[model samples]
Target chain A: MTGLLDTLLAGLALGAVYALVALGFVIIFKASHVMNFAHGSMLLLGGYLTAVLHEHLGFAGALAAGVLATAALAGVVDRVLLQRLPQDPRAAHVATIVTIGVDILLVTDLARRIGGDLLSLGDPWGDRVRTFGPVTVPDSRLAAVAVSALVIGAVFALFRYSRWGLSLRCAAEDTEAAALQGIRLGRTRMLAWCLAGALAALAAVFLAAFPATGLERTTGQIALKAFPAAILGGLASPVGALAGSLVIGLTEAFVITYQSDLHVLGDGLSDVAPYVVMVLVLLVRPNGLFGAKGAARV
Target chain B: MSDAAKHLPRLTAAVVPLLVLCALPFYLESYWLRIGLFSMAAAIGAIGLSLLSGTAGQLSMGHAFFLAVGAYGYVWFSGDPGPGLPPVVAMVLAVLLAGAAGGLFSPVAGRVKGMYLGIATLALVFIGHHLMLTLDGVTGGFNGRSVEPMEIGGLVLDSGRDDLVVLGVPFGAEERLWYFGLVLLAFTWFTARGLLRGRPGRALAALRDSETAASVMGVPVARHRSSAFVVSSMYAGLAGVLIALSFRRVVPDHFGLVLSIDYLAMIVIGGLGSVGGAVAGAFFVTALPLVMAKYADQLPLVAAPGSPDGSLGPTEASRYLYGAAIVVILLWAPDGLHGLARRLRSRLRSRLRREPPAPPHGPGPAEPVTPAPTTTAPSVPVKEHTP
Candidate 1:
């Protein structure tokens, strides 16, 4: 019972972190209709910034700087590169491929700079744990859950009430209609990219916290796990992303916890459990759990 | 002009290149031959991907999975630990095995469309990797397995029998494999071009442009989609067999997500939906890193392999260059190298004739022009529902 509880807590904490990244994917897809493949590298960039600056700026200041810098970089990428492309439906697919190119560039440069070295981000919680009855949890895990819930709640509120959110929703619904109604599609889309970037940066902190061995170059690849999370929820749904992340998190946690019993599936089943779940899910629901079936008009 | 007279120049143009490629093994060193071999193998795989992702308008990120099936299948069929069949039979069976794997996944492949298909196929790569690692009996797990050199009747294609001489040049493994790669590449080119130009090619292209429209025109959408996938997998399998033969070893690491991405990059950089483009792109993408690594000492700002100093290495440098190349090519050219070459040739021809250059319209003097679609037609039929 205690082991199960421990696993549940760990899964919840992982899901929260994954939710942060998966939510980024949802926001970007909703606004621009382009799957952001460069997101993994962007997370790495944010983490790298925080890691390199924490020594001088302190953890809080460095984290704030990192998030803001990442947001700015995403905004610039949209304004400078993606926005310059011809505005057409086909451009969305092209933009997605372009992101793959950008990812390669970012990952290569960052990996070269990192060079097999692990750097600490100097978080407030360093190997600290708190025992709650039968279960012991890391301070960082608790912090992750609390912070993610707060941030996600605030984002939901913003989406529900903010003017930018209204414009973003309207634009995503119908680009031409929204444009006629005086919404700046470019600005709304760019803002969505910036917001997603900020979320990814925040998630990077938790990803590199206790239990993980600091920030390495391949840390970006861990962010790729969020792809299954995002896709499972449907690309356009934020709430779905949260649910999907939790499901994936729980599945991975259970698989790792019970690896000895499931030895027939081979070692390291946890690493690929999310993808397996995703494929099975997709087999049943082509558009994802929450995605609507689009009807074609002749 | 008579038809034969008109075709003479084109025939000579094609024949000249063929002669040059055939003669390369005799003149070039083993290192260059090895590079050529890898490029040829990559070209075959890239051509397969081009058919599926480029011409058929489906996106696949699991190509590496099929390639692995071929590699491991060949190793198991021919090696002592398994069936111990003849190398030629093993090679054919390996390709068929890859096709059967595709057949197993056809139901999903047929139903999934565009970007959705791409993500769905991502599952295959992870699953395939897991299977490769776990099925240690066949795949040799992490360390992988050695490949048996191909033998036809009595002629061996490995350095183990290094006694043969050809025109005063020692016919080593690289030398033998060079001709073998050329033959396979030729087969790929012939088959791929034929498929593209035939009725099936037209149907696939139509489907890519508009699935609804294609189906309305009496094209069987699901069957065609799955068949394209099967054919593409077969090509990837053949490429895998050649890759294994050349390397003399098969490892799970070589067939990873990166290899799939590399194949995608090849088709895109070459000019999607073009056979010549796939070949060119494969050569460029494969050779760039290797050539850069070879001449790292001469290149500025690139540290040698394993250098302690924290500087950009040849591998990283090459990656940056190609990554940027993909972006720049998509941005500026959009039509890729094949298109660029076509335009250049047309311009040169016009200049020689002293006639004013034809306005850059659709087709030029190129034979049987299949205009490569610039974008994949939207697979999702209607407006996305907002929740």
Candidate 2:
């Protein structure tokens, strides 16, 4: 029972980080209709920035800089590259593929710079653990859960009341209708990308903190796990994304913890457990759990 | 002009290139021949991907999984630890196995659409990788298994075989494999073209344009979608067998998501929905890094393969170029290199005829060039939903 509880806690922490990244995917897909494949690289960029600058600026200042720089880069990618494409139905698909190209370039450059060396982000919660009864959890994990909840709550509130959020929601509903209603689609989309970028950057800190060795070139790939998370919830649904992340996180944790029992499936099943869950889920619900079933007009 | 008179130039154009490709192995060194082998294998796979993603309007990120199935299947079937079948039979079975694997996954493949399908297929890669690593008996685990050299009658496609000289050039494994790759490529080209022009191809294209309309038009939407995937997987399997033959060893790492993306880049760069484009894109994507690595020392900023100074390497340089190419091509051209080449050919033809240049956009005067139905026909009017 205690072991299960421990695994559950770890899964919840993992889910929180995944939620951050998955929410980024949902926001980008909602506003622009383009899946940002460059998101992993953007997370890497933010983590790299924090790692490199933490020594000089301290952790907080460096993280702030990283978040800002990443947000700016995301905005620039949208404004400069994606926005320049001709307005057409295929444009969204084209833009999504273009993000893959951007990811390649960014990952290549970052990997070269980092080489085989692992760099620490110099976060304050270093190897510290907090105990609650029989449950002992890393401070970073607790911090992750706390921070993610706070950020996600703020975002949900923004969606509920903020003017920019209202415009974003309207644009997501109907682009032409929102435009006629005086919403600047370009600006709204760019801001959405920026917000996603910031979220990705924040998620990077907890991802590289405590239990993880440090920020490495392959760290960005961890963001890929969130793809299933985002897709599992349905691309357009934020609440679905959150629910999906937890399910994926828990599945992965349980698989890893019970590897001996599931030996027939193979070693290192946890690495791919999320994907297995995702495929099973997709088989059952093609549009995802919360995805609206779009009716064909013609 | 008479029909034969008008067709003479086109026939010559095709034959000349064929003759040149056949003649290449005799002149080029093993280094270049190996590159050609890899490119041909990639071309075959890219064509398969084009049929599914470009022609059928489904995006798949799980291509590498099918390729792995082919490679490992060939190894297991032909090698001692497993079935120990004939190499040729093993190769055919491997492709069929890949098709069966696709058939197994058809439940999801038939239902998932567009971007959702892409993400759904992503699961296959990871799951496939996991299986490859654990199923040590068949796949030989992480180190993978050595591929058995293909034997046809008396001729062996291996370097250890009896040496034969032709035209003062000693025929080696590379030389023998060059011809094999050529045959496979030619087969791929012929079959892919036929499929694209045939009834099934039209049905698949219609399905891609709009699911509802295609179903209304009596197209078996699920069947066509699933069959397209199966056919695509079979081609990937064939390509995998060729790749394994060339490589002599099959590792789990080679068949990863990155390779699938590389195939995607090839089809996109070459021009989506065209066999010729897939081939061109394959050559461009596959050969670029090898060529760059060979000339890395002379290049401006590119460091050699493994310099410790952290400078830009040839592989990294090629990646940057192709990555930028995908973005730039999509942004400006959208139709890719095949489209660009077609436009250029049309312009040159019009100029030679002493007529004014064709309009900047839209199809040029219908030449006797390969009929690209996807290019001329308007795409099905269906609004894409973000599900």
Candidate 3:
């Protein structure tokens, strides 16, 4: 009973992180018909930035600096690389991969420049592990869950009620029609990239903070697991992303905790375990658990 | 073949590599020979990837998984002690097992394409890496298992012998490995060339152009796509076996997502659908890094744990190089080096003469290049006819 609760709690924290990453993907895909392969890398950048800021500059400053830095990077990357893609809309996919390539290069260089022995968010949460009923989860995990939920709720409200959100949606639904309606696509896309970068940064920061200070290749591995969640939730559905992430998170936690010797399976598989569930779900429902079908495409 | 490719004007151009290799043992140092041998193994893998990604239009971010399957599968099939079977049998079995794995994984592709498909392949790489580390009974995991030294007709090659080394320096088992790698390269090249020029290859290319249209035109899109995956994986497997034989060992770290990305990068650099492009891409990528790390001595900013300086490492720069190369090629020559070479050759041939404009085959344009997805087709009447 205790183990199950613990897994669920940890899973929810991780799932919330996945949801944030998936939202980043959805935001870009919705706005530009562009799949940001750099989404994960962006998240990594955010985490690393936060780590540098928090450890080297202090926590409050790091948080602000990470967001600003990533948003700037995202805007520049979007404008310089993705903006000049071949006119043929079908060519967007190829261009997307290229942008991803660029992001990878950028992140790698950054990581190299900020050389360190290990990766860490450099948080001081470990000394205080609190217990509630059957669950004994860390403060950081609890904090991540709260933050993710708050962010998701805020974004949902903004999209549902705001005029700007409506305009962005209209643009995503029909680029030509939206252009005629006077929607500024450049501004909308720029906003989307900035928001996406912010979300990725927040996720990476909280995720790194929860367990330890830094990350390794395992950080990207975590981001990779979010693919299934993104797929399952419907690539365009933010609500689906959150839901799908929970399912994936719980599934991985359960499987590893109960199934065969996990130690042998290696740490890499644990990072990707949720993808197995995602793949199985996709085999049955291709559009995803909550994908709005045609509405998801531009 | 294109108009230029049809006439074999430069047969000696192709024979030059064979000549160089035949003479290389005498001139080059053993260390360089070893690098060349490794390059050949990687080339074979890249050629296979080029077929799957370039010709078939399927992107795999986890080909190293197939390579791992081939390597570990070979080791398992060999005698339980490790390096179980004769090296040749192990190699062949690896190919078959890899094909089987590809076949099994193919169905998942039917449900997804683009980044989703890439996700699946990426999953495979992570899974394979884990399996490599965990399956200690067969793979020997972190410690790994080494291939037994070569035994040619009961005359065991002396591993400790210095005289047999290629360039007055001791090469150990590399000489034997090179011979094996060359044989496999020949086989890989033959298979890729034949497959790319055949009906299946055409079908693959057609599907790449437009999947729904390809299906409408009676091509079995799923089957061909799956089959391409299978064949490409088989090539990766054989290459893996060669790699294992070369190292006489296999490690989980050896077949990771980085390698998968590197393989994909090579095919892109080489040109998507050409066998020659694959070889050229492989050599360029493999050689550039080797030359840079050794001769250029450019250090990576962050030294990976194993490095001496704690400053920068070759491995880190290698990734940076590949990532930058991906961007450069995509932005400039989306068609890759093969595309660049073809264009250059065409321009060179036409440079001297101000020939009269040739009659166009389709649209009567002066330039006969067939740019895909031309918007201004004779289908103007369809728009007029539409309500």
Candidate 4:
């Protein structure tokens, strides 16, 4: 019973981060029709940037600087690279790969500069482990869950009723059609990117406090998790991201904890476990747990 | 240089570069020699990716899977000190095995297209990595295996005579590696070119442009698609063989998702579907890192605004270079270096002959990009999804 509770708690905590990342992925994909493979890289950048700032210039300042940097970087991406793409839009294939290249360059740059041994990250809350009966949770984990829930509500509400949200939806639904109806596709996209960047930044800051792993592998691993959650949540659905993330997080935590004895493939199949879930979900429910079948693809 | 050369400009363009490459080992140092061989090994992977992504129009984010197969397949068959088989044969065996693996994995591709396929392939990479790390027998666990230097009967390739003297002129071992690379390249080059020229290439292009039309026209869409995957994997396998043989060892990390992205970058930067593009892209990507690593310390001014050293950190610089180049190439030069080269060559030739640049690139109208469409900017390593 204790193990089950611990596994569930662990799942919810990690899933919170995954869900936030997924929300970020969904926003960019929904608005721009671009998958934004660089989202993970951005998330990592946010974490590291905040850590660097926090270390150098207090917590509030670091948070402000990190958010600003992420938004600025997102805008740069939009204005410089993405803005120039042709409207016919099959170019996403190349675009996706280019993002990968950008990610490699960005992560490599981060790793080279912050060449520390242990996966160092900044957690202002300190690394304090707390327990409740047999089910123990870290201070950082609870904080992450809290932050995730808050952001999810804010983003979900903003998208539901806000005029900007309406414009974003219009742009995503049919860019040309939206343009005809007076929505500035470019502005909408840039704004979505900014919002998504900030969200990813938030995820990064919280994750840093929790995982504390260095940026190198963290970038890739975080990206990998976000992918399953984002896809599982539906490309256009933010709430789906949260739900999908929790499901994936719980699934992984459960497997990691319980299946140690399974020893199916020598080590934990847990490494590729998320991907297994992703593939299975993709096959059975191509649009994701809550994704609209017609609108979402991958 | 006749104004009216009978051959397509591609053939003429390749001739000079080919000759220049063959003689590279003579001029370049051993350090460069190593990079040259590495490029050749990478070219093998790039060519495969070029065919799959560039020509077939399918995005695979799991290209590293095929690379790992080739790297490990050779070891499985020829186990360092176990077989003493010729390196060329080892490469060929690796290629065949990888092709088989590609073929086995082809079923998922049949029913699933676009992002689904990308997801499936992405899963493969993680699975492959897990297998490599966990399986102690085949992959040599985590530390990876250190292969013996390739021996060609009398010659010990890894060490020994660093250069082969002919006509009293010393040619370095790197030069020898280039020769070896060139020979293998010739085979891959011919195979890729043959595909592009033949009915199959046309069919593949047709499938990419419109699957329904091709299927309607009696093209076995599934079969052709699967065959393309198989061929692509074989190319990757050969590339893997080259990589393993060149290093005289293979680490699972070397064939991770990053490697797949590297291969994709080559094809995209070079010009998809053009063998020349694949080769050029491979060289560009391979050489950039070597050059950057060498020059990063020398020229610190090019570092990002925040980099402490006032110069780009070598590894980071290489990645930064890779990202910037990829983004630039994709957005500004969609046609890649091959396309860019063609445009420049044609423009230059037309100016020299006074015939206006032969309509710039192709005769087709450039697609009108609207501001409304979603912009997928970032590059996802193997198994990219953009439907």
Error of 4 at A60 (Å): 5.0
Screening candidate 3 with a backbone cut-off below 3 angstroms (N, C-alpha, C), the clashing residue pairs are A119-A214, A120-A213, A120-A214, A121-A213, A121-A214, A122-A213, B78-B84, B78-B85, B79-B84, B300-B312
lDDT of 2 at A92: 63
RMSD of 4: 5.6
True contacts kept of each: 0.48, 0.70, 0.40, 0.52
Rank ordering of all candidates by lDDT, starting from the highest: 2, 1, 4, 3
Question: Tens-digit lDDT track for model 2 on B64-102?
Answer: 999999999999999989989999999999999999999
**Candidates sorted by DockQ, best first:** 2, 1, 3, 4
Model 3, runs deviating above 4 Å: A32-35, A54-58, A87-93, A96-100, A113-134, A158-187, A211-221, A259-269, A292-298, B1-8, B79-83, B149-176, B298-319, B355-387
| Leading candidate by lDDT | 2
| Candidate 2 iRMSD, 1 decimal | 3.0
TM-score of 4: 0.86
Off by over 4 Å in 2: B305-308, B350-387
Residue A132, model 1, lDDT: 92
lDDT of 4 by residue, B1-387 (tens): 675675667687879888998777666678888888888888877887777776677777788999888888777666743464666567578789999989987776554566546656788788888888888677788877765444566675554455558556565445556677788888888888788778888887777777788888878988888888899999888777667777876787777777766777788788767777888899998888888878775665565445565355566666677677787777766657775666565566545544445544554322222111233222222212111
The 0-to-1 C-alpha lDDT of every candidate, in the order given, reads 0.86, 0.88, 0.72, 0.73
Per-residue error for A73 in candidate 2, Å, reads 0.8
Please tell me which model should have the higher DockQ, number 1 or number 2. Answer: 2
